[model samples]
Target chain A: MSTPLLEAQGVRFSYDGRTPVLPGTDFALREGDFVGLIGPNGAGKSTLLHVLSGWLRPSAGKVRLAGRPLRDYTARDLALHIAVVLQREEHTFAFNVLDLVLMGRFAHGAGTLGFESEADRGIALEALAQVGLEGFENRRASELSGGEYQRLAIARALAQQSPILLLDEPTASLDLAHQRHLYSLLDRLNREEGRTILVVSHDINAAAAWCRELALLQCGEVVRRGGPRELLRPEVLEEAYGVPVAVGELEGGQPLVAVRR
Target chain B: MSSPTPDRSQARRTALWWALLAVAWLLVLGLAPLAGAAEISLPRALGFGVPEGEFNPDAQILFHSRLPRVLFALVAGGLLALSGAVYQAILRNDLADPYVLGVSGGAGFGALLVLTLAPAAVVAFLLPAAAFAIAAAAVLLIYGMSRWRGPHTPPATFLLAGITLNLLFGAGILLTQYLSDPYQTFRMIRWLMGGVDVGSYRVVAFVAGVGGAASLVIVWRARHLDLLSLGEQTAHHLGVPVASTRRLALFGASLVAAVVVAYAGPIGFVGLIVPHLLRLVVGPDNRVLLVACLLGGGVFLALCDTLARTVLAPTELPVGVVTAFTGAPFFLWLLFRKV
Candidate 1:
């Protein structure tokens, strides 16, 4: 009955105004919910995440956080609420891990003079530990392996200490083991820390196995919202992906998906 | 979470390295003036126990000639390096310098225009102000050119725009030189070759006040700049007011570079190499790099200026040549090392 932590009401968006990417899709993330938004390429999953993160404006309708329109919040105010893990993270410079993660404390009024406080360092270290990067404070960010860099991104988000997290294809470049490990980290953050999460992923099996709920997006519209068992049906996925799809059940009761080709 | 004692210790060690650089900077400032063509005894230069009349030419050689030139180089070089750190952060390219971006050329063009037309009485007063105006406008021009792609323009786009402006500005400078008569053309060439013949402390104070204050503005927002260097989207998510901070830092950095160009002509490469070299010593955190570049660059240019005068006795090379010798190769390595 409580107001959703993040809500999109008929949100429509487009990089170009003439063509809408999110054609009035609707979605919501309640507190403590771990939700995956899975769709084919160009389905507007990342675009919708951008809309929700307030990085992009919706062409129509509105996104609300804590029952208020998202546009009402300043960047700092929005940052105080939602931490984001953007897609295609790049570290071209050699900023050490600790300094990079301490950037998360910026919105918290800690890095005003560029010197973070002891408390800020403590929190950044804790966030690193949460992502299993406990001893990576001095390592160069640009040199990290794919898995460590991905987790470093999460550590930066966690250092924000926000109640809601929005990640866009965090595991796109990750190996299978690292993907599952990142998902487990997300799961712990959701169940134990009581944070709300919405992730956009192309990997359906990974999403189905890890996310507590799944939303299926097709042609810029979120058309199905349910347990993975319901939405992973051959017909639903076949329509979304524009291919014949096969579905099975895992021994753990998670859905298994394969393209008919 | 484990304690980050090592990080804290490393932070302390980095502070020490910067501190050592500061000491070295002071030493360079003190010793550079003594190395010029005409030697002035230290006691006489300091006017120790000497009457005012006795201090005329000897003390003038030190206090009026060499010391002013050295201080001018220090302030100008410091501002250039400070702005270079800022441009690298905002432009997101370590190879990007105000000189390469035509910021200095634009400022120099504005000063050239004033020197050509302005009354000799007020040229000093009008120079840096005009320079800052044109330099800031040049930055706007680059930002506008890059914005056609999007709000988040790729680094290459702006760099391309800037390099184009630098080329065009170079043409403008050449045309200005061609129009002036022989005496005026020679004077223009002297300034163009980058003279630090600052005769008074007032000019040094003026450059430091304007440029040093602008450097402070960028240094104060160093964290915001570091986040921005991570990428605008990432910085925005981390709570940086991306647009406003970028604007202010750009203004501050350009102003600092403008002050330097207004006072000292096209002294190239101090800005380009100082920050790049110091980034190796301390990491790319602008909080440290910005300040380090300030001191490190002042020392670098002062030493180079000293060598300019002393390297070939009785015949001084232009300071720009010395800097180019060191910086051009380093810049080439940065550009082609991975190739």
Candidate 2:
């Protein structure tokens, strides 16, 4: 069997010692896997993502990426391999889109005292184009709409050209049309480019449409891990969310999730 | 990514405008010495050779005293503005200025301590340098104390620490003042008022050396500074050594301010206002903003000094007073505009 592209073994974490946010969670991702992490609020989905991306250290266990311990890699080294799109985008200072995207190339060769090279700019432009923001490069990031800003964040990650992309609710604030568009883009990225994509979303429909694999977490522990078909059952959804959920098939042959009234 | 070709035509236009502005400012700075109470003629002011008779008294005064004062003002003003720009970029705080991190207060306390306790041994150059070094240390200490739980220090915590340190240093300054002699008190008052009358070339060269070196260091790190505005965590994710880069940038800014304060005695508001003014004109890219602040600050201070000298004629007002007067109104305008 091929080695897992990313693995978390017996991971545990807590902001305060009393209630653990993540308790001995073991997870793994193979290459080109489109995984969706679904859980209610405070279920440790974002925490798990932070651990997997090497942004946060697991208290009890270890994370390994590409067969190497995650802690051994510097933040920049990890950035060149894994890109994370955080939930909120904020900057105290305003930056134009082109300049913001170009920051992703900072690790490749741009030193602290160095300027962006031609190659770096090319990657940034290509990333922008991939996200349908080719003409908006000069626009200030602060001026972007919610959907446009989400695309910009994705573009920044794309500019990193990393194999693994971790997005935290990439479509959370986006409209329905933009949501479909973003998932389709993620789908293409995973299928054609063979990128390892992991996304955390509250929308079960979004997970069902794009993710081949699904993991359900509750109270900081993974309760279920399987294909979407197995985890998308009404009972599992009800248990995970503590709300009665009706899972039905749509006319178009897609799974639909609705909270029972 | 391919190299982004900045519009050559636009760049050319910008270059032309910058060149024109620079030349005009230089001419104004040069002619400022000639406009004082004595009114030195243009030919005599520009003359390389002293004429066959006694040196033109007006030209002599202009070249000897007023010219150096104006140069000092220009250098100090430029350094303070550039330092403020660098600090703002590094801290990612729009309100950050060269003195925001308690550097000015720390430097003031240091100089006051030396003046009160060891009056005769207080060397002119050492006063600001000592203050600057202590201020840098204070900043580092505050940062170390405030690192609560995360790799990144929150902006609010940093600001609070700076304010606390400023108050602490202010108290120290009062203590030193109480211990000062009548003679030392008078001198301290004059120094606190900030004068540009550095009567020697060596002082000018020293200020120039410190300010020039610090400015170059800041400009070289301009790209990194731009990335830093996104916050320390993001900058780190993008490969910047956030802690080290921040420390170096802060130190550089403090050094520049320290040198200026050493010569000009804590000239206020140039650091705060020049960066704000340049931001209005050129947008917030540090690479462009920094350069603009440097040139713009020199010109602004030079003009302020000229007004200070010529406004009251024969009896000059302190340039610091002028800067404070101008800076206060501009700051108020900025607050209203931003709101």
Candidate 2: tens digits of C-alpha lDDT, residues A125-193: 899888788888778788888889888888988988899999999998888887887888889999999
Local distance difference test scores for all models: 0.83, 0.80
| Tens-place lDDT digits, model 1, residues B120-211 | 89987887677667776888887776666566666677778778887887788788888877877787777777766667899899989988
TM-score of 1: 0.93
Where model 2 places Cα greater than 4 Å from the true spot, the runs are: A16-19, A110-123, A251-253, B1-25, B42-63, B121-126, B147-150, B178-186
TM-score of each: 0.93, 0.90
Model 1 score (lDDT): 0.83
Candidate 1 CAPRI-style tier: medium
> Which residue pairs in candidate 1 collide?
none
Fnat of each prediction, in sequence: 0.55, 0.42
Candidate 2 per-residue C-alpha lDDT over B170-235 given as tens digits, one digit per residue, 9 for 90 to 100: 888777778777888777767777767787667777888988998998888787788788777567
Question: What TM-score does chain B of candidate 2 reach?
Answer: 0.88
Runs of candidate 1 with Cα error greater than 4 angstroms are B1-11, B115-130, B144-150, B332-339
